[model samples]
Target: MRTISHGISKIEKGISILLMFSMAIVVTLAVAFRYVLQSPLSWAGEISVFLLIWISFIGGSLGLKYKSQAAVTIVVEYIPENIKRMVMIVGHICMLLFLFILIYYSFTWILSPSVSYQKSTTLLVPMWIPYMAVPLGLTFAAVHLLSNLFDIFQKGESQ
Candidate 1:
């Protein structure tokens, strides 16, 4: 289980790094084409926008995996230790529920007629390809949440 979790973390991180690199390359090429060549690549802006969306969603999933999302812990800090555990469990449950909703609706949206009908203006690529990030990211987040919950429960049982 530990190995599987670590492997997923590595895969997520690798994809995130690739997304970042792709964004940088796209922007750099767009700028260079516009300024140096005096003619911008027609697809550059559209493609960059699509890639940026992918990057944001994928990075967000990795953030959840690492528990890197921003939080206000002031209230939790003031709570008694016993209550803090309950609060944390509740928080995890809420996150799990939110991700479940995201996964379901995103899958539905991906299969909807609108996504199938739409295409990128320049590339003519089906919009669903880009829209796929929604479900994929949510699935990653769900896995991370479940793994954390399992670990928490295991620790409790051991204690």
Candidate 2:
């Protein structure tokens, strides 16, 4: 379980780092070209936009793995430690369920023939190519949530 959690965290971090760096490069080149050279790459914007989507979804999972999702922690701060842990476990369970549903529906949408026919306006790439990031990221987040829940359960036992 520890190994799985660690591996998922590493994978999430690696993809996130790559996406952020690539987005910076893509946006920088797009800006430099449009302003400096007076010619913009049509594909650049589309690629960057899609990359942003991927970044956002992947970052969401990373946030869950790190337990950094912003909520009014004030509410839980005063609660008893064990109770707080249970509350957070429930929260993680909710996150897992939501991600599962999203992945299921998004996957179906991705595989639909209509989706296959749709293409990005500028890049003309199949829309599913960009859409796939949603399920992939959500699935990773789901796995991380499960792993974290396991950790929390064991934590309660040790305490």
- Which candidate's lDDT is highest? 2
Candidate 2 lDDT, tens digit per residue, 28-69?
Answer: 999999999999988998899899999899898888778898
TM-score of 2: 0.92
Q: TM-score per candidate, in order?
A: 0.92, 0.92
Name the weakest run of 10 consecutive residues (lDDT summed) in model 1: 1-10
Runs of candidate 1 with Cα error greater than 4 angstroms are 1-3
RMSD, candidate 1, Å? 1.5
Each candidate's number of clashing pairs is 0, 0
Q: Per-residue lDDT of 34-141 in model 1, one digit per residue for the tens? A: 999999999988888888888888788778777899999999999987687778788899989988988999999999998899998999999999899889878877
Each prediction's whole-model lDDT (CA)? 0.85, 0.88
